[model samples]
Target: MSVKSYRQALNEALHQEMARDPHVIVIGEDIAGGAGASGQQDAWGGAFGVTKGLLGAFGPARVRDTPISESAFVGAAVGAAATGLRPVAEIMFVDFLGVCFDQIFNQAAKFRYMFGGKAVTPFVLRATFGAGTRSASQHSQALYPIFTHIPGLKVVIPSSPYDAKGLLTQAIRDNDPVIFLENKLLYDTVGEVPDGPYVIPFGEANILREGSDVTIIAFGRMVHIAMDAANALAKEGIDCTVIDPRTTSPLDEDTILESAEETGRVVIVDEANPRCGMAADVSSIIAEKAFGALKAPIMKVTAPHTPVPYAPNLEAAYLPDATRVAAAARAAFTYGK
Candidate 1:
């Protein structure tokens, strides 16, 4: 198989899904640019050019462009999903979820439960998220927990190129609405992805490295950081098993709890805030379900409970890095005093 970047893998997934299902359609701003302008059509092909050749391949009906209104387009996407089509809408920045939360949380997320499991919204909302890029508070935010708290929606935070493609395909095909958060920094990160269509089940936690010393649970880009720490920790004889729970909503709590029980220690790395975040949620799970398997108090490496800062230094500090993840792992490994 060819080595492809995370961004390319996602693009390929969209291309494959669109080709496979006539019901699967993409809608968002400038998905295929120059709709009414004098310039050539399909000019932009998405803000990051992920949907570049889709317009040429599928034509305008499938690869659609919408106005700069998150509510209108996102609402329309939810409606279309409820009707029959599996729509993949690009919200640009997840920070823009503010304008469309009503449609997402109120409508799409609650439809199945509200309708007594009669309605199925097979929709995927792909949006760029996380700090870095210096886009500031308004643009950069790792807001996964908010969606995770919702019952009827599935939240996917894929850390690698392979996961990106597989999880995205699953999201498009699944009966529930999914919020697929792609880190901007990870767009260029390269990895091997299957050429053919494949699916990664939501509740399965992938153990990146199996170790007995400590278990590190992470999601999205934080998984990479935890894996980095595990690689370095292995040198010092502190082996860490890194688990990426691909989808936060379906959560794979069984796998996480089982790993925690086996290792007797856990370090959770989350890119979001400390309070009421995924780190806290996992820590609580380990505490309740596998409390007897505690070799050390659970450690959480996460951003502070504050808005993402504008400055590069603060932003870097705000985001959990490999160094921070390593320190947390060290704490868990060295605990017992």
Candidate 2:
């Protein structure tokens, strides 16, 4: 095991996968910087430098850069995947999905089902998401819920470097279209990761902290936030279990229900807007299936239903933090008691 940053983990995953499978290729804007310029190549390595060394290792044929048009390249990725290439296309930011929604939600996502189960679109759409860099409203939205809502797309959000490496490997190997959303703020966060390639199975909820008082279900970057809250809650004799549903699409409802039933209280923390977000969806699942087990009402701590603010203070307020999560857990623990 080695301690690595989330960005390094993702970069290593892409490198390992490309080396293992000849069919695996990468396509995105500035993925291989200095496409035709006089300067050095592989300059940008993507907007976050996650795809940096790939161009040198894989060469231009596999690590191809594309125009800024999301529709054309994303559509091309869909075509390439249908033609037997495992393409990992980077979208720069999740908010840019608006320009190429049809290619993802309609084309790549529906190929297998629409073709009588004969098509295998082994495509991974990697995008930087979440609000912490203060990239403003257009670039910082946590839009994982939008992809999670779609049927044919598999969504994976890893909160740590270890999960990022394992889950990206799985996403590349899977025979279905996968939306791999990476929280921009977590790119620099470091965690222990295996040296060689590994895969973390989807739909498995990882229990970060086991507790008896309440259950906290968090996704992506919010997982760390939940952990912070759980640690703080532990001091006040209110132990809490934090579950990270690694893959949002094939959600680990069983683990969620089990924890909810055991704790008899739940506080869902999501970075996305409250309406129709993962927090609401998870709350509904617990309310419907584990209603009798619940001792207190389910509390949801999420971002407001508004665009991410540009100002640092407003952005901080817009995003759910450890303080809010701890408060929600306290509320759940004290309800009706």
Best by TM-score: 2
* lDDT score, candidate 1, position 98: 87
Give the Cα error of residue 279 in candidate 1, in Å.
0.4
TM-scores across all candidates?
A: 0.97, 0.98
Off by over 4 Å in 1: 33-42
lDDT of the candidates, in the order given:
0.91, 0.93
- Where does model 2 exceed 4 Å of error? 33-38
Highest lDDT model number: 2
lDDT of 2 by residue, 41-155 (tens): 6367898889987776778899888889999999899899999999999999989989899999999989999999999999999999999897999999988899999999999
In model 2, where is the ten-residue run with the lowest total lDDT?
33-42
Q: Please report the TM-score between candidate 1 and the true structure.
A: 0.97
| Local lDDT at 235 for model 1 | 96
